[model samples]
Target: MATCQPAPTCAPVATCQPAPTSQAVCPQPCPIPAQFGCGPLPKITNLVCATDFDKAYIPAMYQHNMDIIAVASVGAEMAPSDDITDLAIKIRNERIQQNQKLALFARQAGYGALPVDYNEVAMYRNQLMGVAGMDFSARWATLMVGLLQQSQQSAQLAATRATLPQLRDQGNINARACANEIDALQRWLARNGLPVSATAVPGVCPPGAIAAPYGTGPSAPICQPTCQPTCQPAAQPTCPPGSQPAYPPAPVY
Candidate 1:
């Protein structure tokens, strides 16, 4: 009965303050996403090709090359001792080199060039197969003029249409050379009594080539007007008072 006595509260019941409840650390609310999406997947292809190419340019260039060969074969047999023959040979070699250069240019432009193994001379070599009893040189001369003209046109077209600067310049050179060669061939044909074409190519430079700075076109006349009086009427002089005016004085009649 003595243990059951209430234990005396030490210095008033210590106020048991509830442990301070720490505020719950609240995470910031995530913002709703503002983006959207699509419906179906797309189909794609893998095929590829060159971009920005002229379909006609390379073929026409090749044809021009063949034309050069065709005409070259005609003059190949000409004796080099002959000046005309020598000039023709020189032209042939030069043109071949130029054609190859242009072909290289074409290849660089993502376009196909004349194949290395291609037989440009094959057709020209057999040119005589069908012309029975016809003079091969003469007959070829007939075809040569036309082929040369076509080649020149091709060159001119390239000069105007080519995208490369070097190609355009080379094309202009070839065009002019081709024109001169055509004229020379015409004269040669006339001298040898071979057929000559009547067709004319405009815008071709004269035979007198550039002899001065920026003198690539037709020659300029002396711009300095004549110092002598040009507008004054001619002075009609009396033949020494008509002394023996006629030859032998009209036979002394």
Candidate 2:
């Protein structure tokens, strides 16, 4: 008991530890963030389609269409045919009559009524001497020659006028056929739900291709309707009291 009491009375000694060395703080490498999404984007769909477009034959069909377009464009240039030869003849006949009248007046005025051309006068004088003898009036003879010449010229014009109608009709037929073919193609494309816009596909034709520089309208001029004059009945006259009114006929009468 005496030994334990003596040991408890002694004081305990304290030990000192060294300070921590402050090395530069090292940084650790960071990992990339994980991505969360609905997977890869879906492929876009092609809306335009041709029922007959088998990859094998599509190019040929396209080329054929282009050829048709080319011919159709050229065909549209054909003009409609018309025959105005009767009108032309009437015009010439009128001109000849006027000249004859002028010649007749010249003769009556005591002026030298010889033919305008020296050669024509000589030819007329010869013909007159051979046909009607020297007794025929020179002025009348020359006028007859002029009339004959005019008749001949008119006949030649009529002959020439008849020749071009066949060619013109052919051209018009070709043009119409081409137009129909083109229209059918357009309708088919529309029915098949094919793209009609030029920009819809690379190298495609524009929407105007169906009607412009390519497909033109009919070249024939429209025939205007004749303005028929109507005869209106005259209005009845009105009397003022005991006096009768003097009335002019209706304006259309």
Candidate 3:
């Protein structure tokens, strides 16, 4: 058999390709005015006045006027705790004295001097119990005002409860935005022949892909090496002093 001619040596093929340029993709900007929808408008307070006028006009007017006065007085009485406590104490004492005076007046008028029978005594006792309960309520109302003034805990409690839903919504929105960006980056890295694993983690760039160096450091140098015409030996990843290598060498084909 004839000896085989020596195979001709060919130039080594270039394995390193230039990293693909990343397309400048930006997220669609959020809309202004937020496209927020409002719920139905409330019926105006004047509507109540109009309806009241259509009914027995004089009585309706009187009732509405009294309602306004009562609301105004209650609002004034329930002003900040510092101002309300003294007023509440004075009101409670006056109310108790007035009830006692009314009871005495009724006894003198022969309206409450009934005989001491089980039914009569029971009725009187119930009336006295009701008056006592009202007095206790007034005293408790004053005590509550004092308690509110002594601590700002209630205000803090209300603020904490109000912010909870807003905080939860913000967290959810951030997480979703992060996931979308990461997915896009993974696809980009894979298309450019860079090793990357898909992940759900937000804001994290794909691992193992080379990024342009930010400064003159070795890890991110000012000038990058260009691919040679022929495939050269793969460079070993440089490790910092006292640092371990992150991965094993890629297998040579």
Candidate 4:
């Protein structure tokens, strides 16, 4: 009692934190997509250990998505030429099917892919369009032809330049798909009275040819109701040039 002053009339209010105001939080998008949209670095190293194959393959995958996304986006803009609606849809559908097949090669190799980023797609769309005032059909066809040519070129390079047998097979499949899609795009352009390049791959049907009854939607050949053989064989492994026989013999007892 000697040192203690009179008890404070009231204990000071205990300092207390109001329960943190629970603010609503928005979820964030996943920072990484599908493991960098391919595989982690070490896995890619294991799969494509050879030199420069990755260079060919990575660009091929990029262009694959570019063709799918940009071309599909352009389809919606074809309202100025409504007559080609079914054909446009058909082309989009075909590319999607082909892309699924193309993508499997990577997935089976333990790499996978993500869809092309929307930002890249928007850039592609701008690249497809030119000066604002130009007439729609002709200008659009010219730009589209340019794009398809670039797509096919990249695919063909991957086909020829990839050293690994698996990559070579994938390149062939990818190039074939690009060829089909370009042919489809050309036909779509031609049927709508736009000029297709004389040197472009010829369409299955000449310009202005009418699509068959089932061209669009599930009935289309590419999207047949029955499951088709979308998966192709991977390349078989081989022995090194100077290593043991290409095929190993049965072990002797």
Best by lDDT: 1
Task: Judge candidate 2 against the unseen true structure and give its global Cα lDDT, from 0 to 1.
Answer: 0.27
Best-to-worst lDDT order? 1, 4, 3, 2
List clashing residue pairs in candidate 1. none
Count clashing pairs, candidate 1. Answer: 0
Per-model TM values vs. the true structure: 0.48, 0.16, 0.16, 0.43
Q: How much RMSD separates candidate 3 from the native structure?
A: 34.0
Consecutive 10-residue window with the lowest summed lDDT within model 1: 38-47
Ranking by TM-score: 1, 4, 2, 3
Tens digit of per-residue lDDT, candidate 2, span 1-253: 4454332333332322334443443332221112101011000000011122122112222222222222222222221111112222333344344344434444554444433333322432343333232222222222222222222222222233223343233224333433443344344335546532211000222121111122111111111112233445544444445443334433431
Deviation (Å) of 180 in candidate 2: 1.5
Residue ranges of candidate 3 with Cα displaced over 4 Å: 1-80, 113-253
Q: Model 3 — which ten-residue stretch has the worst lDDT?
A: 35-44
TM-score of 2: 0.16
How high is the CA lDDT of each candidate model? Answer: 0.47, 0.27, 0.29, 0.46
lDDT of 3 by residue, 1-253 (tens): 8997766654343343334444444433222111111101011111122233212122212222222223223423444343333443443343333334434444554445322224322321232233333343333332222222111221222223323343233224323433443344344445546443421111111122222333211111111122223344555554455544344444443
- lDDT of model 4, residue 142: 52
Clashes of 3: 0
